[model samples]
Target chain A: MILQYLKLLKDKRIVLASSSPRRKEILEKLGWNLMIIPSEFEENLQWESFSHPGDYVVATARGKANEVTKRLEKCGEKPYLVIASDTCVSLETQVFGKPKDRHDAQRMLSLLSGKTHDVISGVSAMLSYDDGWHEIVFYEKTKVHFGRLAPEEISSYIDTGEPMDKAGGYGIQALGGTLIEGIEGDYYNVMGFPLHKFCSTMAPYFGRLVK
Target chain B: MILQYLKLLKDKRIVLASSSPRRKEILEKLGWNLMIIPSEFEENLQWESFSHPGDYVVATARGKANEVTKRLEKCGEKPYLVIASDTCVSLETQVFGKPKDRHDAQRMLSLLSGKTHDVISGVSAMLSYDDGWHEIVFYEKTKVHFGRLAPEEISSYIDTGEPMDKAGGYGIQALGGTLIEGIEGDYYNVMGFPLHKFCSTMAPYFGRLVK
Candidate 1:
């Protein structure tokens, strides 16, 4: 649907400031040329300080974008755009990131069993201008309903080791998909980026070509 | 969650009676040993003959399973199980399949623009018993909501050559994801196979190991 933007954005120096392969794959599907630059920002933000989980993720994503942008500028490399994103699973007041260990993954999965949780992703786009960098930050939330998981189920899933590197101790694109009952929002949001929201948000920057 | 069934089902001969790579990929994610044997049944069922789209798809899936089962029996190759599936996109009473040409794809995409549609998949699992074959059939539905698409956007999407081979003229797991606002139900269902539903439905055959 965005094929028209191919010519306009093809030559732009777009830097993706995250190490997530899922996010990179999503962007590549749109046929954009991207430069991968993992953010060096320490993700030690106090989740309790933020009033909402969405705010917390957006702040972290902005932190990543700022770090990568400044690092590039210091190197005298000014890119046209820098994109960063953070995803977390939240149940009520609690926020869950990657599991620290097998036990932590088991704990997180147990808590999420037979319950509905929110998959929140915060994205920041740093657009380079002659004067400075213009930042746009936003968050997308998707409701995920997990099936009733038995103790054995959680243990087996942990053994697979897929939960260790994923938020909420699960990756929806792989075997973790079997653990989910359904979802009530953009499916891509669960993967760490909101494709539709990102496209719509950046629609203005590409100019009103498609209308 | 289903790791317990690995040993029990690993040695068993499982034949998948469809050529769709998406369905094959979904099943493979479970770490199951699968034998790809695409069905020879022709998908020429009249859509108007059925009372509901779900019924039509189920009948089609059954036809595929029956054809493959009989064909294998003729060759004296009775596998443990045979699975067949059919997927279609329905906007109210109208059912949409693969687009015939570019104009047809544009027409289908235009009808689906800025609207919600149901992605229905019918599955049939045939198990061989001493007496004969025991069959289980079911259908899953997922609601997909698409964002408003401009004419150029639709044309450009068609140009990508993805719409010609996919039902509803889009693939939600690829560039089509950007065109979708959100979805309600198992995301895999929209991808041509309902992973969660398929796993849950076959839970009984796998036996109550986790309990």
Candidate 2:
């Protein structure tokens, strides 16, 4: 369904501006022979200034995308599209990134236990056109409801070390799927890529961008 | 989280009464040692008499689970649990199963294009206790919206051969993910298993069934 619209870019040089395995896997589903270019952009933005969690991720994502585009142009490799993304778990104004340690993971899970929290992944699709670059930025938020977790359950999950590198201390696609009671939106968004939203957003613009 | 409640059944003789790789993979996430026992139930139920799609699948699933339980007992397997399921795609009164051929797949895809339909999965969890068997039957319905699909898109996807064995003639986890505009319920339900609903339903009864 998606490949038909993207037939124009099937043979184009496409770069992903992040090294997230989940993102790579999601995009790979679109059958893009992606050249991974990890962004050098530092994520030290003051998130409090943003009006919503979506904006914060979009800013970070744009940072990586713009940096990668500049780096590619410097190397005389002008790609058709540079995809960048940033994800964070949020409860109101609080934003949670990858847990620093077991304790941090424990805290994040505890806060999320028996309650609903929002997972937002912001995407920046940078398409280089004839006149100039057309930038498309959007965010997807999935409301995840966690079943009540015992202290032991949290500790045991942390012991597996799955939470150590994942934002908000859980990989929802794996063991974390068990922890979830139900979800309200795109499952891939919680996996760090908003696949449904991304495809719908970028597909219509393919014709103009390709020409 | 689910594994913690399911530790009691970890070593028990558990049987999955279907040979579907998708169902097997989804259930395997709970960390159970499963025995694949394909049921010989002919699926010859009077599906037209059923009031709803859910009831039809539940009837088929129960038939499979009960048949498998009888067969396992005859072979001296004496399974602790036999899980069975049946899935179908429905739009209004219409129900669709696996496509018979490439043309059938094309016809189903065209009917589903630019429209929303229900993916219904019925699950039967049969647990053997001291006195008798505890049987639980439930169904999950997820509304899946497909983007408008062109004839070439349908033909191209049909060439991949993914639609042959999948209900609705599309595998939402693979190339079909692109066809979906959005979904409104458990994503796994569309994948042929209701993981979240299954865990929540079975977890509370684990203690009684184990003893």
Candidate 3:
């Protein structure tokens, strides 16, 4: 869907406001030349302050995008567009991010075993025009069904250390894939980026999103 | 779910009887040491003979696995287990495989645009034992919803040369991600190997299948 705009975006100054390999790899599909400027926004937003997990994630992503855009603008750097993303695991009203340690990962995994949870990803597209930057935020929620995990299984997976940096204590795109029974939505959302949603959301700005 | 058997499968002579990079990448998550041997079995079976696309794909995978197993056995190679897989696109009763040419790919993509199609993958696990070879076959279906595509867009994607070797004229794991709206079921299934289903299905034979 977004590949149609590759030529138009080829020369644009695309700034990816995140250093995540998953987000980078996912966005690379558009063939957009990108410059990574890790967002310096403090990700300490209070979870209880939001009415919904989706809103919190979107706000977080927007913060990242806005910080990157402002930093570039301060340096008089021309960035046609800045993209940011944030992902979290949610069950009902509870939200979880990366685990602090192996025990925490195990606890998160055990709590998720043999149950369905939502993997939510919020994305922000900050486009710079002649006047200023215009922003749009979107969220994708994927229902992930985890298989019953043995405590020993969770312990060993944590030993591998793949869960330490991933939200929900697992990376669906890797070893953690075995722990899942299946998913009911965009798998990329579970990978920390929402590919389809990003493309469709940016589709409307085809002519203007790019320089 | 399957990580428990990684140590057991560590020493087994596991061979993947296919050359699809996507399958190899997806299967690598299990940390299984693998050997790639492209099956020489001709995929010329008449599709019309099968009652369902799933059956045809499974039969095709079986053919590949059997041929590879026979070849390895003749060489006195101890291939403890061999895995082979085949995938196709099914829309209701109509089924589509890799496009024969650019025009064919364009045709397939056009038909799939703005419509939901099923990505069906059939896998065969041929286990070699002292007495005989035991074969197990399985299939997974993923519903892929595609966004509407213009003819120009299809032509451009085809021009990128990403659709030729993939089923349904798209590789969901790559440039084709933009074309998909979302997917329901195991995402790996659309990539040509069903990881979760493979692990869960082989769970019962854990002890024997691994070592």
Candidate 4:
């Protein structure tokens, strides 16, 4: 399904501007042979600057895509399709990014204990058009609920070191799935991509760019 | 962490009556050197035999475990522990098992489209003791919701032949994850085993049998 869309961009260059292995794996599954250009743009933008969390994530993704696009353009290379994505964990009003330490991870896990939260991932696809660049931004959200965790269970899981690098202090693809009670959105969004949306949105642009 | 518990079962013979590679893979991850004894018992039990889906599943799992246990006894191989599990998909009030054909798979997928349904898995663990055999049975329920799927999308996915062997016409661990909006319950249960319950319930028996 993904390869069909990639076939449309046969001759055009495609760049992925994120260092996430999960995103990279998903893209590879779609058979997109592309260059992995990690974004150098720092993600220290203030969350309060944007009205909605979705906007905040989209803006961050756009920033990363633009950074790679600028680098490519400076090299006298023709514009390519740059894809970047940002994901966050939200519990009601609070937004969680990757945890900084064990304590931070513990805090995130405690807040999510026996409750549901939303995982929102914003994606940005940018291409160099006739004049400058055209960009499209969208967000996908998945609701995940954790079962009540015993302190020992949480502490033991934390000792596994899986929570340190994940948003909301849990990696659902691993031991984190054991803690989950339910979810109401895209499972891939929790894994760092919204594949269905990615495929559907890119379908129309398939033959246009390569031809 | 799982290995720590497995150490307690080191002295006993354990049998897993399943041919599923996925289930064997999960057990291997837990460091269990289990004997694979696939059962030949027919899965023709009527869904209406039990009042609730959970009861029906528990009965089915018990049947599988007992079938294997009786065979082991006759062969003079009295294994200390025998584990069996059964999983099913329930949408609203309708129950679904493995698809009998492509049309059956499509029907199951269509019923689950854009709706939340329960994935119920019943697990049975039997231990042979001095007097006779002690058995424990329990069920785990995970609610899974499918994103609204276009008929064409369903047809395409069905064409992949992934749903034919899965209980719900979908396998959440593969491309089926793309079709799901989210799931509520033990992810392992949806995958066909309830690891947490299996570990916790067997912990006590480990001490008695190994020592």
Ranking by TM-score: 3, 1, 2, 4
Task: Kindly report the root-mean-square deviation of model 4 from the true structure over all alpha carbons.
Answer: 4.0
Model 4 residue A210 lDDT?
A: 39
Best by lDDT: 1
Whole-model Cα lDDT per candidate?
0.91, 0.86, 0.89, 0.78
The better-scoring model by TM-score among 2 and 3 is 3
Off by over 4 Å in 3: A209-211, B209-211
DockQ of candidate 3 compared with the true complex? 0.79
Cα deviation of A151, candidate 4, in Å: 3.1
Q: A134 in model 2: Cα distance from truth in Å?
A: 3.6
For every model shown, what is its TM-score relative to the native structure? 0.96, 0.91, 0.97, 0.81
Colliding residue pairs in candidate 1: none
Which lDDT value does model 1 have at B188? 94
Query: What would the per-residue lDDT of candidate 3 be over residues B44-162, giving only the tens digit for each residue?
Result: 98778999899999999999999999899899886878999999999867789999999999989999999999999999998776898988999999899888998988998999999
Task: Encode model 4's per-residue lDDT on A1-211: one tens digit a residue.
Answer: 2333344464667788988888887666545677899999999987777788888888889889888888888997754678999988888888999999999988898899878888888999987677877888899887886777767667877887889888888887666665666566566788888776776666566546535
What candidate 4 gets wrong by more than 4 Å, as runs, is: A1-15, A26-35, A74-81, A127-133, A197-211, B1-15, B25-35, B74-81, B127-132, B195-211
Q: What is the TM-score of candidate 3?
A: 0.97
DockQ for all models, in order? 0.78, 0.55, 0.79, 0.31
